[model samples]
Target: QLTGISLSGDQKQKPADLEKELDKLQTEFDEIENQIRAGSPRYAALTGAQPLTLAETQQKVLDDGTVLLEYSLGNDTSYAFAVTQSGVSLFKLPPRSNIDKLATDFRAQLIPPKLQRRIVGIDVVAEQQRGLGLVEGPSENLTAFVASSNALYRAAVEPASNSFGDKRLLVVADGALNYIPFEALVRSTDGADYASLSYLIKSNEIVYAPSASVVAAIRQSGNKPSGKNLLAVADPIFSSDDSRVKGKAGVPAPAEARGLGLGLESAVNDVAGEPTAAGGLRLARLVGTRVEAEEIGKIAKSNGSQADLWIDLNASEDNLRSRDVTNYRIIHVATHGLLDAERPQFTGVVLSLVGNKDNDGFLRTDEIFNLRLGAPLVMLSACETGLGKEKRGEGVIGLTRAFMYAGAPTVGVSLWSVADKSTADLMADFYRRLLGPASSNSASVAMRAAQLGLISGKKYSAPFYWAPFVIVGDWR
Candidate 1:
């Protein structure tokens, strides 16, 4: 920490004493030429209009007759030396955040702990750090979480700032990462909870972490998560009423955000006011077509050798293995679909009434890493099953992508909300045709048959059917 030099107490030194010392150093500047480096040494130019180096050399003229030029040495950094009768100098420094933690001649030491899976993603409003504006974390993990959290804290560092207490999100795994509990740390740090440390990720309906984000939400919702406060944090995002993405913040809503109608009682009224031509959920609904559960079940059962169509809605999380999924030739989830704005990659359609983490909640595009579909076709006969965004312009993003990502040959997903009764009716007709002995070849042919059944009735012709559903990826 030291290079053998230290400062005298400035409180005792005062302005008068410091002035006397400066006078002494300045008066004697001429006497130290033999020792002083008089050459015009070059300095590395700084970029972005920032300083390359701090004041390395400072020579001040003082009132006293004698002059002083001093040089001081320090550790791990370079600085200029001032030569005078008194052999003393000051050190220069820049912003602390920019200093690298460590350096290496080899690449082996460059890794940090792998990002904890507990944190799936985060949503940050705005943050300020080191005078930088609007900081954001691009991924979920300790580094990004800490960085985003640090930005919030930094916003409150200076005078009259409230950004520190703004709502911040951290997605943590329920069982992964053996580090300190993030929710507790936030509580100790003057932060409000997101209702609970827990939340329902649409991927699998698996509540990963009852994080602060979810906890604060529950309090706002006026609903308690039963027993323990920490064990079961409340979720605000689950409320269909308050959890809406208004484009006012310039943050794009995920494609599935449309489908997470779990909390959207008010959205029913709001969505009706939006331009139908703009698409949105209206277009999604236009594409949606519903079918009867019994009919689809019958078709799947016939395909699976007619084994009671045993779709266990009450399956335990531990027992929700991929093997259980293998028996059925078709998987039909009558739950919810979520497409997040910030993390469309984590976009998924959640299975209802399941409790398994990872597999239990939020079925993402990648978790099916080893899943191979034996089912020639799959139907996510759920809400907003086909919601997604086009890379360019305003169009539709298909829920079929997740099935495709999971290796399904062909998937039939609805684009928007569907009437349960109508969906049931449409499904019955669709399956009657799909399961007909003549229905064979590719999934497209079968879907056409289902479409025929869907529009056959005027009651099912809404966007909720025809416009809301789309077949995607390879269909063998």
Candidate 2:
């Protein structure tokens, strides 16, 4: 059985320092193995054996009105434990077979091509209703979606949620469940319309953790980093042939631009009742995220805090891999994240493809643990960066855990592909709120503010545009 060891109460090493220690231990273990292979006498001694108990973890981490829902997903069935500081309750949720399909269906509905044309200057409720009509075209689709959400809620949450009332939920999901948007799960008891009471976010704040021990690790390392306050890297060149590589004023190559145009044309064709390949909808460009970097940079600078904003050629993978980001308080990467679920180790964040004629830009999953990043929060503003191949006991084996293993206490990631422009808007709002005076600097609080802005804002009220972003780690 796999056991998660939490940090002892007196342990005070920074996450980066802890990461360094782990690396040293691994090196030592490797040396010991070599010595054993050479037929030399080798000995290893273990010191501390105080594994954190359930009560100790609750006492150390759970605040009042906070419920931790930890899940264990087996091949056919799944079990859940709802824990608070006071007690724990177990519940049996729907099997993976049922949830996998429903969640996949919900995710398919969130794709941009499936959503309605978002009209500006309309009332929030009206706009949301319009979006529902377009996205959930048939009346039966709305009923089915609602039924699916309600079924998930009842099985996974209702048993525990009723006891916790309006408490915020801290979910530790496993397997395909890691890809779920808990906030989007609906509970309709009063016959309210889809836009009126269709989302769990309307009821409570939801966050995620890789494990209970990870939560303890995060809370123990909650102190802010002492180095630069913000590091925002965005708008990287994904190809060496990009015009910006030749210093042509940050323009895309003519062929690439044309390809993007064709991609859009194909998307339009899909919207006009013509079938198109799923890859067509996945098309992306050198996103206009330079503005996002600049706006966030201004926020960090406003309060006499230091901020480093890297864009275009400067946002190379080599730059990220070589630098020790342990000192930064916040690290934000606004680029494409290539998720290879079939080969999770190949999953990587796309950075500057080639600049100054050097360095491949894909930052692979395996390479993440090599970095020492003690930042309290690392934001991946990219598509499906949160997903990975499911392991039996390890949960989603992806970049989120990779970043955590690298020493980041929290990682903000997207569950699905998001619109570049909407992401920029949401991120700008998030940073402004997070870095402002009188701000709590609590990532989840700031994230909620940003999500609320998108949900209520005129331009992007649809849940598909905003609900995908989730904070997985310490919400504090």
Give the per-residue lDDT digits (tens) of candidate 2, residues 91-162.
777777776666666554444444323211111121212121223322334565567677677767776776
Q: Model 1 misses residue 447 by how many Å? A: 2.7
- Show pairs that collide, candidate 2: none
Q: Tell me, by TM-score, which candidate is best.
A: 2
Question: RMSD in angstroms, candidate 1?
Answer: 30.3
lDDT of 1: 0.31
lDDT of each: 0.31, 0.64
> In model 2, which regions exceed 4 Å deviation?
1-52, 75-77, 112-144, 189-195, 219-228, 247-284, 356-358
What TM-score, to 2 decimals, does candidate 1 have? 0.36
